[model samples]
Target: MITGVYSMTLCDIGNTSFHFLENEHQFKVSVEDTIEHLNLKEPIYYISVNKDGEKKLLRKFPNAINIEDKIVLKSNYATTLGVDRALGCYGYSDAIIVDFGSAITVDIIAHNNHLGGFILPGVEKLKEIYPNISQKLTFDYIEKINLHTIPTTTNEAISYAINAMIVEPIKINYQRYNLPLIITGEHGKKFLNYFNNVFYEPNLIFKNMKLLLEMEK
Candidate 1:
């Protein structure tokens, strides 16, 4: 339902990076970079889960607006839920939203009402676990995982375990809810092989941001 040209810039600030959408072009800036050096001319409407980054960005961009309050959606989630997770549920009446970032967040929305969901360690974090247990256990994740075949080697075992850890819970939830599965974030597309009725939207947050901005008008 949102129509017309969107000339404004939108940002989603996280702990490690600043994700930006300008005239449909998306890019990221590292948190270590100086914000003022970017010399952005336009006003940026943003949402932030990173408190320190939010403060720094606000000081650098006087015209920047935080649109967190403008994102009003039906939910029964606790007050402590991350803004990113809440926004993922936007425009979805019944679905499971899985965001694969530094941490994977799974949120459920049923009949336009957000039910509470769970979080799991992401691929990077899961990779870290084996190394901590033993030096020999350290191994990179495989590109392709065959769930049906039993793992024979150490690498295969680790790979299968990692995939199962991430995928099984989602499968259980999908079976319980029987709703469309929505996947987003950095590793969203990689998960498409595991589910049948799954959708991958890398710019989900940005899409929701645009919709929220339109509602503000």
Candidate 2:
């Protein structure tokens, strides 16, 4: 059997998952299991938010560039911002990017200014937190139900609360900034109803990666 060399393989390494993309094929797995199954002997490109995970990925695939290193932000902040946030806002003059991953982040860039954003636990983490606060508040009974404005049952209440807690801040910031909204990450697409003019681009990181590669060449 001939082993095919994958081109433009992009990995967005995050705290909770490693999203691997090759052309149109996409795979997501936990960080611990990624190295074993990933076909990365050849050159690849990646972006990592977890420092330790990045180190491990580098040890496994030395040829790959940490795409974050190639990025040059046009704006400044008091504290350091995350590279993933930078990439999401890259190439956009004015926009809001809501990344719904392990941690939900609402990154804002308006008029080429990196205004920073809000961060909160993702819906899964939020659900985990509820059970810790009270065992009776467990989400074991909850299914992936569409959020309702006025929830009637316990499960509905928890579901709505979880979704609202994540989306409300993004909605508020979008209204406040009045800029274009670009949603990405795991749960990014499910937020379409929250905004009037929002776009779901799951490939924002990969698009940024490709741009970086083109700049290098």
Candidate 3:
């Protein structure tokens, strides 16, 4: 109900899936993985993500303050502060952040940036439409295969389509920006082989919240 957060729900919406982390004194998710798992009921801090697999999450949370779309941030850089801090930690700024999530988001961070990133359906999004429209295509996890360009088989086609769409746009944008480029989220590491001078961070949004909270007072 209020604008401020006692706990931060940092959600990174991608083309494929949503990855979120809750951080204040600690970090946890509805589903446990890593970090210090905390008790859910008395959670002072909260984080929720609504990505590819589940769309219901976006509707489910009682306090669904749109981390990006629902709220207009003062600066674009603040939009990506979570992982930006990691980049800053490595002495880099003014780069492009292309997160390959449920939706492929191409964002331009102008040295000291602002929010309002371009949101596009991820590589798999096209394939997800296959059964209804194409009737000839299929889907598969892009990481397991070794190929470039679009693959020939249905499975391989999914792989190549997602990878090429995901990678090429990044290369073009990074070159145009001529600054450091960062690839993060679920699909980021899968295609790390094709790109260079890029950084891969798994928990950027969560880490960003931790860093921002530390700076307060």
Best by lDDT: 1
How do all the candidates rank in terms of lDDT, highest first? Answer: 1, 2, 3
Tell me the tens digit of each residue's lDDT in model 2 across 1-217: 3267436688888887788887778888787774755675356788888887888778877777776777877776654788888888878889988888878888888888887777888777787777888888876534445655588877888888887777677778878889988888777777677678888898888888788777776
Using all chains and alpha carbons, the TM-scores for the candidates as numbered come to: 0.95, 0.86, 0.59
Q: 38-65, model 1: which lDDT tens digit per residue? A: 7563768899989988888888897899
**All models: lDDT?**
0.87, 0.78, 0.51
Give model 2 RMSD, 1 decimal.
4.1
For candidate 2, what is the TM-score? 0.86
* Model 1 alpha-carbon drift over 4 Å, by segment: 1-4
Give the TM-score comparing model 3 with the true structure, all chains together: 0.59
Instruction: Estimate candidate 1's alpha-carbon lDDT, on a 0 to 1 scale.
Output: 0.87
Top candidate on TM-score is 1
**Model 3 weakest lDDT span, ten residues long:** 38-47
Clashing pairs in 1: none
How does candidate 1 fare on TM-score?
A: 0.95
